[model samples]
Target chain A: MVARITFESVHAGQQLPRLDVPITASLIVAGAIATSDFSLVHHDKAHAQAAGTPDIFMNILTSNGLVQRFVHDWAGPGARIKGLKMRLGAPNFPGDAMQLSGTVTAKEVIGQDRIVEVAVSGKNRLGEHVTATVRLALP
Target chain B: MSGTEKNNWLEKVRAMVGREALPPQTAADPVNLPMIRRWCEAMGESDPKYLDGTAAPPAMLFVWTMGHFRAGPGREGGTLLGLDLVEAAGFTSVVATNVEEEYLRELRCGDVLTQRITLDAISEEKKTGLGVGHFVTYRYEFSDQKGEVVGRTLFRVLKFRPPAKTNETAARVDTDTAGVTQPLHPRPAITRDGAFFWEGLNQRKLLVRKCGSCGRLHHPPGPMCPDCNSLEWTTQQCSGRGRIHSFVVVHQPQIPGFQYPLPVALVDLEEGVRIVANLRDIAPGKVRINMPVEVEFVEVGKDFVIPAFRERQAG
Candidate 1:
């Protein structure tokens, strides 16, 4: 099992390690089908083209999963995500690369656990793909 | 991507920001085992709590709000005509960019959820790597049947014009169901007292045990009647007519062997006994509290059947 992060070890202004992820057509489509999102734009090339996109692109569910994975991997297994707020900035199309990074913005002791807030961003070659804030609890 | 066109497009679609993009609707199913299994499989999550039916993963909070493929009209709010408006303005492509959810409680089986959605914000035209478009956001409020707030979410998607045919080849259609199968529900745990209830279901009969001493009835074939506390009891066939006492549409954990948005209900039987069962023959969103229903047995697997309810026809 991966080692867990303790509340005492984390502090504001700490930067998490960055991870580079290669985006693919299959990755984008797999996310849609897995989440039961049947929108044509996420998988159908002809339909997506007609809808005015370069190709089928990643869905929000996939982006959310990526974001979740990015944070949990850093916070370790025992950490609980309290909340997440995100905004889409760029498209994550197939054949592009996404690099995810984050910084601890604030930490406070709430009840029995330490609640740490992190500002995270996913950027691709085109530019920023996703930006969001995630709240997690560490014991 | 001209300035004049972008301005015009934003102006037309911006009118929807304060409107109800999606109508309030009930979930089709209560939280169940089948959907939960599927979600875990997809996400590669192996949390023991989910598998043992202890607590659903908090990340799945949004899944309970989703409408299934065969879902009826007015059930979808986020991608309503607002997206169409942007598409018409030549911002023809759309992709979900962001999602944030705050879970207030753990979802469990048999908990019915109702959700209301409001369009929150629409960004002005902006140029991005994908193309020139606007970002639209929706705020979703989820509550259980008791009207307790379960969770809230803010979702954002970008509607943009696609960059010129970028990928040399078209997107491939995938037909990859390598290891997927229908999920068999957890079998009923039959004890000496409950054995008769299971047997009744297999016999296509809905039975409520009646106290031999007091004639007071109790469902689930208890050893002793609750009201009279009598050990001796006999079973009585039910009339199968009832009203929906309470219900919940389950959305999460995507377990196999069942459909999404499954509706489970607590029925107030005409015999004055209450039983919990799956509701059928009606759209999950269309089921109303106190709606009349009748019991029916559905054959799920070989030699196994479960009681399900259907909307009763009005006289």
Candidate 2:
């Protein structure tokens, strides 16, 4: 019962609204069987294009669970995720539709919790995928 | 392409873990936080207390070593040597450049976590425009349920190529004298609070301790004051100099008896403290960025020694 994304409706370069997400190899083998990560370049695509990876390669624990399900479905449900950092430039194949975006650089409050600081990215259709650093915790 | 298909995928990963050492079946289950908030919203991570853990943010304990799963037998032979070194080198993709972790604790949930992988290193070079690939380095070590050690993961695998065959000639392996550059034999006894900072770095002097309550200056030696835990200190001596805040030429050879390009350095001393040591005399793509350095002291086994850094000589 928590869904709130409203730091005055966010500004500082506002974007957050891309979320395409398609990528499937059975959803990356159900996210490598929910993160036990048997690693084979994330589930062997002929050993991930023979270790030069072109496919099967998005398993930094499902890219941190798709950046915690896009900030818990758009910063809601009592939003409280605090420190996340993503850095894996490319690679999220499967069926590939992937988009996921974000912006609001800083909103601020700190003491009684009301921080924002977003700058996420995860594109597709061949563009600029994977690039993150979200820090929400508003109330 | 012989030797039984190069030991047939490491004997099918040693026949799927056939020398059991007892340590697999780990998933005490607890950290699901909506599957870690749908993997931090597919890594767009809007860290709301790592998706509401009541405010737990310590690098989300690096995703609590990703849940857990360690059933053995060549433990799937390191995933069939990444599918036999990408079907015997025909590379052109594999990316994950840097991911240095070193957290020690703070991973809650049910906390069953237990990993012990050990495919320490694996190498292969030749990149005349990214051609002859291979650079595997896995060394997980996650432990939980009281045993301690909450983290340490170093999984780096590049492998990408497409140009190399003008008459092949880049495979002359076997030459890794551990960390190389040796000399020190019997010299370890810097005891109690790093005995006068190893007697002022064995006389070559470069001491630093200052901390009369957070005045801060410590280097490698600690007994307190990581910013005012202060045991009230004092030592001073650094003139040995510094600079070069970052470096690395380590032609991906993951220490297992190393060799083939190694130039590690992170020096920043002037009593400021940075130390990641090991650079010696030049070469390694020249090295730059504040340059000017000093301090040296090799020597491998036996009494063990380490504190390397060079390049310094201006007015």
Candidate 3:
């Protein structure tokens, strides 16, 4: 069984562990396969450049999943994702390293669950790539 | 002889303890335009650039792989799980709380595209009035024909079930909303060329552009067939019915000043035309996959109307 944690156990303004994830061609390819999104911008570099993009931009879907993974791994299996909102900033290219970091914003008790909101962001070697608001529900 | 004997012994031990190899997760296929175009048309996209290759819109890229899992063998090998896992775990419904996308490049026809997908995270939380729910996150990377990267998208889906006590309250709310239901709206006044389409919608029917040269059904009401560039065409009325191929309930609005808690669906009509429209008459929570629906015209404003769907009554 997974261990349970509460809202009162953690402090507000606490920063979670940072995650260093490598972005690879294979990782991008696998994401496309799973999502069934086959826009040329994700696969063809020449096409992307021709269309005025610096490089292939990472799918917003994949970035959200990455943020979720980073927080879930830290919060353990018991943490439940309630809501997440993010804005696309810089484009993520293959062969770049993405560093994900987050800070706890607030905590409160709603019904039988304890909820925590985390402000998260993903940056690459080129600087900030994406940022979002995450709400997690804990026991 | 002794050195050979030692190497053989090491090989035997390695064979006994099988190496753990990570499963292969790579997309190797072309982005089928026919499939995507069908989805765009079904979603009520009327852009000629999407059909003409003149200028493709950004959102049309989302339809690149609509129902791709069911397309062919070996294609669905990967674990492409969506927000539906919560439903399998007994959740009543799932909604998209938010979605943000950026277009790195425009996709054109004949561009072979590839995608990579991974599960980012799944977390649960309690709602003040709706009870507990889980949010699932997924990441996607898109590539084009020449093995060059293009763009990426991140999506989050929120799945939830009604609390035992809240079920009754939800049903009551649904009933109250349905009580004030109004009739289908009238069609808008369109010009000479676009008149036939509006007329068809007023009659509760779907129309497609039939190409003269290719004899294929074209959508988005184009003047010339993209395949042959022939301008000759005719309109065909189709049954205003289809199955819910895929759908999402919007808990958060994409545009400001819009209403919330709307169920939007991608319907695959019987005439082989797919369009996106708002699902009506049924309770938001009761919407399901493969739900039979019939099209109805709803007037949004003066001289403007849209096609909507209502759940077909069971036999």
- Clashes per candidate (backbone, < 3 Å): 23, 46, 55
Model 3: runs farther than 4 Å from truth? A1-5, B1-315
Question: What ranges in model 1 sit over 4 Å off?
Answer: A15-24, A52-54, A94-97, A111-113, A124-127, B1-17, B71-91, B127-129, B161-315
Residue B190 alpha-carbon offset, candidate 1, angstroms: 74
Q: How much is B282 displaced in model 2, in angstroms?
A: 54
Least accurate stretch of 10 residues (summed lDDT) in model 3 chain B?
B166-175
- Winning model by TM-score: 1
Complex DockQ per candidate? 0.15, 0.10, 0.08
Q: Is the docking of candidate 3 incorrect, acceptable, medium or high quality?
A: incorrect
Which ranges of candidate 2 are over 4 A from the true structure?
Answer: A1-16, A19-62, A69-98, A101-121, A125-139, B7-114, B117-143, B146-315
DockQ of candidate 2 relative to the true structure? 0.10
What C-alpha lDDT does candidate 2 achieve relative to the native structure?
0.59
Per-residue alpha-carbon lDDT of candidate 1 for residues B1-315, written as tens digits (9 for 90 to 100): 588876776776676677877678777777777767766655455656666777666666677667666656745435564777777777766677778899777788778888888888888778775567788888888899899998888877777776544322222222237632222443454678987887888899988888999998887677887887889988899989999999999887544346779999999999999999988878999999999999999877555678999998855
Candidate with the larger lDDT of 2 and 3: 3
Judging by lDDT against the true structure, name the best candidate: 1
Q: Which has the higher lDDT value, candidate number 1 or candidate number 3?
A: 1
DockQ of 3: 0.08
Comparing 1 and 2 on TM-score, the stronger one:
1
Tell me how far the alpha carbon of residue B236 in candidate 3 is from the true structure, in angstroms, after superposition: 65
Name the lDDT value of residue A68 in candidate 2. Answer: 56
